[model samples]
Target: MDYSGSFAQEWQNEEKEDNNQKGRNRMIHFRMKNNIGSVTVADRILEMAALALAVFLVVLAVALYHYLPERIPVHFNSVGEADGWGGKGMIFMLSALGVVAMAICSAAAYNYKMVNLPFSLNPACLSQQVTIIGRMMRVLSVLCGLLFIALMLMTTVPQWGMQSVFFSFFLIVMTSMTVVLIVYTVWIYKKGRQYR
Candidate 1:
């Protein structure tokens, strides 16, 4: 009936549990590192699309430079009417802005480890969570490029007499995209929590 033997056995069980947890954590980390080496085809396509869009925006601005009016619409009212005008040079600035946004989002995706997620993630879920977030950033970058292209077309092609209709449609598209992104982000966060 000696108590020392029982105490020692309990301590060994605790140590074993600790070792098992450490091994699981190591496995998770290994998986994450392995994922970095294997870039998926989808990821490549998304990155390519974003880069192509950025380049297209710049080229479009340059091609339309001489043709655009000196005073181009820079702002729109609630009714989708051009309420503000600015120098045609603003088109280049708009294109540059889109490129900058694309670059930023791409950078964020590449450096997902640096991103400050809203919630604390379990170590076991870190790899999957970060990967999902990175992909989302890339998708958002592509969406931003599209939004800028739509704005440029609406402002530059006022002669079509379809600006208001296009503008209204653009707003709806923007809102829908935003909603989808938000829902996706929330889903990722919730899924991460399940791994805990």
Candidate 2:
């Protein structure tokens, strides 16, 4: 039973089959890796943008509060004729609260991004910490975004006579960005499952 020729040929065939399989596996893995990387990068960028918007809102609120009395229309009603501070003050407080909530949501998002970065850079090291933080941020962002929307609605709808244009523009930007952030958060969650 001198089976050298047949054995060699069989071995060669097996080797070729393995090589092809390995190539295909490598391609699939490479694509998955690229998707994970892209999703992680997108999440980070979204988190940063959220943070920046939060800060901008807070500052804008403060500035508007300081300048509203001297710069806005004060003759809307006779009740507000003597001093418009009450109406301006109410708007300022609600806007400030909304900004604060947005800031908190942004901070949570930043933490989520930070916790997940290691997993993105090296999926082998994903742990419970990242998963928990990511979930927490997703929940917090939704809640905060909702609260901000409510605050805007309560404060803007009634004051349409005074702040219609400004509130409308701000609401549009805030709502659009909030929706985008929610989508990004969901994407990150799905990608995180892949790592797990």
Candidate 3:
């Protein structure tokens, strides 16, 4: 006689789980919808640029094959001196690794919108943050690719001294990445405040 009451209670429980006070259902739907939908033009362009940078590294590595000596410097010292050497073939591996890194970053950028962010906000703000993250990932990927390419060339060419090269490269790349992180932090702070 009370089976109907039990069924209604079960349904209500399920609804409550799906729809919390914060509109969990809406938040989830927004996340899923905007994940692929909110990709900005700049994000797409940067991702493509990352792919191109990888390809360029590969092509450049191949071209350098003829110029690189049988043994090339593989590692450098803090003072910009070569402390390690390897076969010329290893040059390709450097660029190949860079390409792989770039690919991973590009994938991350493409899927950044799907990542679980800590802050809960309106769909528009969420989309904006996602796009920013995607663009940043793409930019960082390109920077990584460029760094590898530069390293490869520096190691292969005899005229360019390794002195201070890595120091400069790391300083520049680290600075750029730090700036991105700072910007993202500020963005999250401001957007989070709006929701609070």
Whose TM-score is greatest here?
1
Give one digit per residue, the lDDT tens place, for model 3 in 116-161.
4565546556566666667667787888877787687767656555
State the lDDT of candidate 2 residue by residue for 1-196, as single tens digits.
Answer: 8899999999999999999999999998876543322225545655555565556555655665654444333223423222232455565566567666665655654444443432253355333334444444644554454445444343433435644554455456556656765665565556567665
TM-scores for candidates 1 onward, in order: 0.77, 0.37, 0.70
Q: Tell me how far the alpha carbon of residue 89 in candidate 2 is from the true structure, in angstroms, after superposition.
A: 1.9
How much is the lDDT of residue 119 in candidate 2? 29
Q: If ranked by TM-score, best first, what sequence of candidates would result?
A: 1, 3, 2
Candidate 3 wrongly placed segments (more than 4 Å): 1-34, 113-124, 159-170
lDDT of 1 by residue, 53-162 (tens): 99999999999888898899988888778889999999999999999988998887777755576777656776677677777778878888888888888787687788
Q: How do the candidates rank by lDDT, highest first?
A: 1, 3, 2
Q: Number of clashes in model 2?
A: 0
Highest lDDT against the true fold, candidate: 1
State the C-alpha lDDT per candidate: 0.82, 0.52, 0.74
Model 2 residue 119 distance off true place after TM-score fit, in angstroms: 17
